[model samples]
Target chain A: MTAFDPARFTRLDQYGHGGRLGIRYHAKAEDWVELALPYAADQVGDPSTGVLASGPIVTLMDMATSMAVWTRRGVFAPHATLDLRVDYCRPATPGETVIGRGECYRLARAVAFVRGIAYHRDPADPIAHVAGTFMLMDAPAKQARA
Target chain B: MTPPPYAALLGIAIEAEGDGPPVLLLPFGEPVLGRPGFVHGGAIAGLLEMAAIAALDQALQAEGGGRIKPITVTVDYMRGGRERPTRGVGTVTRLGTRIANVEAVAWQDDRARPIAAARLNYLIERP
Candidate 1:
């Protein structure tokens, strides 16, 4: 069975919210995936400071975490976010691309546990921290689907 | 209060009235869809956060305005958001001198039954 390919999955994102938000794949590991959100004027949460909105950051983490589950399982399947929590350490610097990395730590029969962080330049200095769980819709299978 | 650009991106509109928290609306569209038949979880979270911010802003405006900075937010999704317009409203539970706690709920057809809910904490810098 072939492992889930985040690059291929993102390439088919023509009509999804992630595509509209300009999210792109950056890197991937066995249990984690990193995505990038370029700074845009339209995504400004505060017009005065040009700070990117928490919403878009949440979106970036959500997609990254979602993909992390697939990467961990070595297959793509249907799932839904059950709950998510985000803590903002600071605001993103204006005009810098926000990189989000999500890691799937535990995969159960019915749910997947994930945590993520969003940072501008260094992963050590994250702007936001995220923890969430996704409800797995399909049962585990031996063969991976491409 | 002027709606920010992110509001426009999510198709969020404020339905404000006489000196109270505004109701935020998110219409179903391609920009909000996640898995074809359902609205994205992030979009729903965004709506709830906007609602919480609106409520806090209204409360702060009544007491001589302040800058609101989000500290943390936790959202729980109870149901899958279908292809329809969703509504969200936030209520301030406690507004302290430095910190504020707010809760928001989002629903599609029935306000009594929420599809998602969120709890948010904010740091307020008084003006």
Candidate 2:
């Protein structure tokens, strides 16, 4: 089993309500994190249209990727996203919770690569896919203490 | 009628008015961040899309003109964006009867080192 840390996951209080994003940490995997995007944020636009706004999906993937890195490293490393590429496969239905699992595929001294997918019920039918790289920095000594 | 939802939400201001190509700007703000202190990639895409669409809007207006809608866009993020005002410059790649292509880049600090770059394809509604 992989080591897991609780501190890496963002709590409910940290998220905005309605579309409040939630993260669930798996005890068995240190580098794997699951993100839940509630219906409020995920189901914007029209239900019949089946067109979820790309904004919320992007936000979810971005947060998930960052969390995956944070979990593996065991601390919140100061980082900036160098690039994020998202491809929309299908629109996620409103009123459905979309789950995203992100993994840090590779990490260099200063750069980290991440990839993940968002799906509603079937992983085989993904709603969106994302690939991104983040530039990491050593935590400031002061922040590291707290 | 109100302006397009995206234009209003993004606060993009039209700088020059014409059919050749339109120019717009996205004011930098904290709300556009991915991390606590970094600009969000989605926000960058939004900015790039706006700039591309605005350029197409200008071209259509110039032709006296056509309706423009987005087909697809791809962005390559280069560097981290600083917490300062940035500008996006867009140029038309092709303006045909039914399709328009545009390229744009967002820069802060120096234009030579852009924070992000993108290419956009738009479907034009010809009159």
iRMSD for every model: 0.8, 5.0
Candidate 2: residue pairs that collide:
B19-B58, B19-B59, B19-B61, B19-B62
Worst window of 10 by summed lDDT in candidate 1 chain A:
A137-146
True contacts kept of 1: 0.80
lDDT of each: 0.89, 0.64
Give lDDT tens digits, candidate 1, residues A87-142.
99998999999999999988888888999999998999999999999988895554
> In candidate 1, what are the lDDT values of residues B1-127, reduced to their tens digit?
8888988999999765566688899999999888879999889998998899889988998899999889999999999999999999999999999999999999999999999999999999998
Question: What's the true lDDT of residue B33 in model 2?
Answer: 46
DockQ of model 2 vs. true complex: 0.21
- Top candidate on DockQ is 1
Using TM-score, give the best candidate's number: 1
CAPRI band of model 2?
incorrect
